[model samples]
Target: MAAPSPRPAGSYGMDASWVPWLWAAIGIVYLVLAGFSVFSWGAPLWVTFLVAVLGLAFLAGGALFWNASAHGKFLVWRELLDELPAPARVLDLGCGRGAVTIMTAEAFPRADVTGVDLWRSIDQSGNSPAAAEANATVNGVSGRTRFVTGDMTALPQFDGGSFDLVTASLAIHNIHSPLGRRSAIGEAWRVLSPGGRLVIVDISKVDEYIVHLRALGAALTVRRAGWRMWWSGPWMATRILIAAKPGASS
Candidate 1:
């Protein structure tokens, strides 16, 4: 594929942009109520002060959510990218709009990166295979990257032991069930070549994944991703799980 003119690479777009918008909207409603309480409702001073403070807190929370989605997640991903060894074939699960996909392609210039997704906008804002492809073009990695419409729970198009590196970022949690997430993780492990690495960054149910991978005999290490990955606050912090598939890569 011919590479399109390079756009400034920072356009990863926000994850679930409506979340922050909703938080800010609620904050505005509270602020309006706080003003009415003090001016017309004739409420007590402490009550109005409390309402105003709550409004500000919600607004701040929204800002943090927006920051994490647009910039903070990428910060954490960049660090993870640096730590990754170069792979000849990379597969990214649920790669919404190519944020992690394009980054991996750029990080490993020789690697052929492929992103698979269901293109559900609920999981991410403006998510589509076309948008992901366009993002790859914008980042000048179109030549080496491809996006496909597929479910992580069942990737029948790919053969077993097809990839050297498999990655997922805040994606498997969308499965919404322990069994479904386990199936997705199992597929990821299945596609991974012997001695390959599977990296997952998720906000919930990572322990369940660890348990499942351990059952598959994968050597695993997991760590909290820290403040840079906090979606809304520390309570929603993400975790990274790295599982090394045993044996030697042919």
Candidate 2:
């Protein structure tokens, strides 16, 4: 097997190389569509509407396919698992393909990690329980990890204050609407123990994401990964948002 790459500096998590290419391809496709819209001065209304619809379809398709990759999973693992304490109990929301779940088990050897996902047929790729179990065995953390199929908006299997850390990596945007995302966040908040941390890493509406965290009474801190510095720099870089439940004062 190939050796794992060394972690990058000033990074709290794993480096994901494929994200840049995926974003570039999506940007190029949308730019080309916009160019066509400018050039087609006399195009019919329906034609323009069709082009717009197709562009959105392509964007969504690309995002879903990209999210299924191990690289994306690694990114989530890095952002969410890096700061957690040992012997932690972690809940991975929308744990597609169990990449993040398995990685968490391996990285935290002492922690118990549980993954939950909707497991919709369309989004299902190689992230099944069998794959996750095999990965855990290979990584020598089989005792610490497990995966379950479930929805994020309603995590009935988990009781309130059950976990030390709660994470949703690139999964929030998959919800059908803003209200759905909020409900998912609410579920996460409910499952976390007081003083536990919540981490959400995704390309979503920043304002809305922050608003949901605020509504949960969490104190938020945002960090930019080094990989995103080339394009977005410190200002608009891909983010890892960290929030904590209020803890008792000393």
Candidate 3:
């Protein structure tokens, strides 16, 4: 695909709160301490060696953070885009700053996309409807895209059989109540016409979500997001689930 227009300023984003650079920060501090120890007069050989080793470990940890929390999130969008087809109705649940939302619009320009989010800064920096709109505008898909503020659990606001594709990215697990989370998934199911599909990327209780969706009588697949898709790598937790509502090409 051709390169997109300049990404909207302060619209595309990173959330420091989601995965803080504490490991990277600590690595820098350790390297500094190791250098200081080496240069200090009469520094013990073993102490310097130990500090160097510690620094290396933290550095590796930082790489994991960048891979899992940063790069891995984008893979979610790539996979979803692969699954979606053109000229379809799409919804993004908890589309913080339109990261996945705008990408979807850009990937399938013919498709109509809508992003809904609470836009709570505490949820993710740049998580706002205005940011999402600006992102879509600069990305050259604003004409076919829109953002709205709404709760995932109470998304009955959308009419039944209104959408062909629905996505939730790293957002649904925030629903603390089991009932609320199930309801939110149900809402996703409700908006889908036959043959519609739902894709979700989440951090916890993925199996629970699978069980919930299965109970709702849909065909679905659930699996670990794996190293490339897990920003935190295999340990920190991430999962992908895809479900189809059985019917047309949605």
Which portions of model 2 show Cα errors greater than 4 Å? 1-3, 6-76, 121-124, 226-237, 248-250
TM-score of 3: 0.82
* Residue lDDT tens for model 2, 87-147: 3799989776566666677677778999887765344444456665666666666688788
Candidate 1 vs candidate 2: the TM-score winner is: 1
TM-score of each: 0.92, 0.67, 0.82
Candidate 2 weakest ten by summed lDDT:
6-15
Give me the overall lDDT of model 1: 0.89
Worst 10 residues of 3 by lDDT: 3-12
Write down the lDDT of every candidate, Cα atoms only.
Answer: 0.89, 0.66, 0.77
- Model 3, span 97-202: residue lDDT tens: 8877777777776788899988878667666788788777777788988899899998867999898889898788888899898988989989988888888988
The order by descending lDDT is 1, 3, 2
